[model samples]
Target chain A: MYIESQHNDRVREWARLKTRRGRQKSGLFLVEGERLVTELLASHVHLEALLYNAALDEPPDAVWNHPKSVDRRFVLSPQAFALIADTETPQGLIAVAAIPKVDPHYPSRVLVLDAVQDPGNVGTLIRSAEAFGFDEIVFGTGTVDPYSPKVVRASMGGLFRVRVIAADPARYLAAWRRRHAQGTIVATAADAAERCDRAALGEQLALVIGNEARGVSDALRALADRTVAIPMAGKAESLNAAMAGTILLYEAYRQAANGAT
Target chain B: MYIESQHNDRVREWARLKTRRGRQKSGLFLVEGERLVTELLASHVHLEALLYNAALDEPPDAVWNHPKSVDRRFVLSPQAFALIADTETPQGLIAVAAIPKVDPHYPSRVLVLDAVQDPGNVGTLIRSAEAFGFDEIVFGTGTVDPYSPKVVRASMGGLFRVRVIAADPARYLAAWRRRHAQGTIVATAADAAERCDRAALGEQLALVIGNEARGVSDALRALADRTVAIPMAGKAESLNAAMAGTILLYEAYRQAANGAT
Candidate 1:
């Protein structure tokens, strides 16, 4: 069915998914553009609605072709789509996916976030973490809503693939420590921390990423088995949070993949 | 000199630094906020002017006290400062710095950008590249202006530290080949590329970073002595351009620093 009015219940609901609070209340989030919608179709994630701008001659065939998978398909008028669109140049399609319930599983290699407020950094980290074969991503207190559209978009469908667990950091990690007593819990700092090469990174590890402005919190740092630093050879103060996190993740991946002790 | 009018010629000139054309014509760009302005002051980059809101009774002494080193200081009225401020929360200070003249030198380790176009990514790569001790950053054809404010801001002042060279990709690499005949030329790709671990990286090398959407350009690819891929064990197809560039850069730095051939 086509949605022509911005005030229509479906359009309004989709618009609400754009926000963090609305995403929490509804337990849903919007995924836009052809690539993400296609990813949405392929993934087992529950979908509420598949939307397309009817102004186009036809929506991309990859999406329309998978009509059997979509729960509901809404063809929106240009005006209605415009009202719900996040970007200035909308790709003419979007999907509403149900947020998965939290599942705290044993993590083989974990990417732990502590108050990482920037949605873009969070998404980029997710994408990198996924590429590096990380199993679980735990969002500790002070982290942004991962379901926010910018994070979802930046994740490039990696969010669906990885198991994202949001929990109170100190408590969750404290319990995690009990479960995986042998696993190394790693955090990075600039001056005081040892170079990552010198750190004893094992096969089973958890990387604790911190806030953009501040490094890891003292509370979180106390929980870490070891703290390491990516050695800087140049004059810049430090790497960006995302870059530092990704590098550490890459280092962990490298050690695991190459059988480097 | 408290400039009170927004329409003042000096105010208009400062405003013009926000644009690419104005920056190019004037051979200058803006450094905003207290941190960045402080960074600008610390760097050897020549400063044309320092402006602060006269409403403060006086500018911060760090800038104001360095009167002999600074070419000019204009204490702007709050209205004039508002007109010149790029950010909503203005720090009430800005610095206009002279863009350095292009100097051609054979870099031991080079970062060559071939159309890698997000301003943030470009800036992040600069930060990482510098942190990893790449000798020079060459913005090949299609790369965003390194001096752009967003890039400068995202670079976290690494822009000031790195020797930035903008040149045509094909011509620059070709000429570079003649000068540094012994240096290894490297580029990265997802498919049909040697795994980075397997590749023989060297101390003197040129790492070619590519467009966000596309891999390295044909010209750059042709120039590369070898193309290596960061092996991915996870489901995500590839990493973002900055992440990819950074990982490769980290690998280069790793090989160089660790004395691992």
Candidate 2:
């Protein structure tokens, strides 16, 4: 069936998923842009529907073969396309997909986010972790929702590539310490322990980043095996939390690549 | 002379400085939030004016006595404060400051940006450079203006602490090579040179980051002493440019901290 009406109930329902509450209720989120749609098709993600304007180019034939593909791909008018797209310049394509289920596993190289309220930061960190070879990201309480539109855009399709699970970071860290008994937990701090450059970051590590305003929670910090800092020579007090975590992730990659650690 | 009129010419002029053209013509830019204002006051930057509402707790006396005192300070109503602040929650303080003139110099450790257009990326890169001890940042053509409000806010006061100058990056790199005769010029590429982790990044280096879509310009790449990439194990095609640069910067910092060549 074609979704020709602007006030169509199904169309409005998909549009409403832009809100956090609506997305949670439906367990669905929207993806835009040709590149992102292409990525979603390549990944093992389930797409409920794909919408595009006839004027725009068609998506690849492979996109239609996904297990959850709906019967019809709607052709929206230019106006309808504009309404659906988050970007000012509509890419003329959008997909409604169920949020990928993330298993709450004790990942070997995990990223722990503590109250990183900016959706963009959360998203960029996920992208960086994926880029630098980290497998899983765990968001602590007070962090922004990973599925927010801003984060999904900022991540540049990283949302589909990484496992993102949410939990109370302090409790998770405590539990990991009690269970794993062998994994290393490194947290970034301004003035503590050895500098990150010189620290012995082992392969099985959990890196923790904290809130934009407050540093890592005291409980999380207390549970860390080491609190390392990126050394500074300039007047700036600290790096952005995302950048801080990226630096550490790359550092770990460097050590692993060189077989130094 | 306290001016209370909503239509006051000065108020109107200050409000207009929010735009790039307005900032260029007036040689002033807005810094909102108390933390940035405090940093601006402490730096050598010239404060054109300071505007705040009575609700804010008075800043420490030392903040106002910095050599660059505001030419004027206005206490406005909350409504007036909202008109000037970019943020929804006005921090009750905003200052207009003269753009600091950066002395263009070819330093041993410099960051060269090419068309990295995201204001947040530029800002965070500047912050990372400051944290990891890079000396100067040189923006190529097509790069976003570092002084834009969004960039300044994301920088977290790194703007005041770092030396940032703009230049045609391609020509600058070519000229620097001829002048220095032996400095290492490292450009990041997806499919070239050694992995960034194992590259022999030397003491005297200029790190170049490229556009978000195209990577580095062909001319700039040709000028590079070597091209390197951050090794990736995950399915991500590439790292965010700022994250890639931050990783490279911390690698440099690590090498330097260890006194390794």
lDDT of prediction 1: 0.83
Q: Of the candidates shown, which would achieve the greatest DockQ relative to the real structure?
A: 1
DockQ versus reference, model 1: 0.58
What level of docking quality does candidate 2 show?
medium
Per-residue CA lDDT of candidate 1, range B13-126, in tens? Answer: 889988989899999998888788787888878888888877776577887678533548888888889887888878878888899886868577888989988998898899
lDDT of 2 by residue, B177-253 (tens): 76667789999988775887677788788999988789999988888889988787764354777777788888877
- In the order shown, the candidates' DockQ scores are 0.58, 0.52
Clashes of 2: 0
Model 1 chain A is weakest, by summed lDDT over 10 consecutive residues, at A62-71
Instruction: Please count the clashing residue pairs in each candidate, in the order shown.
Output: 0, 0
DockQ of 2: 0.52
Off by over 4 Å in 1: A4-12, A53-58, A68-71, A76-83, A88-91, A174-181, B4-13, B53-59, B68-71, B75-91, B174-181, B235-237
Worst 10 residues of 2 chain A by lDDT: A59-68
lDDT tens readout by residue for model 1, A83-146? 8889889999888889988688857578899999998889889988888888689998899888
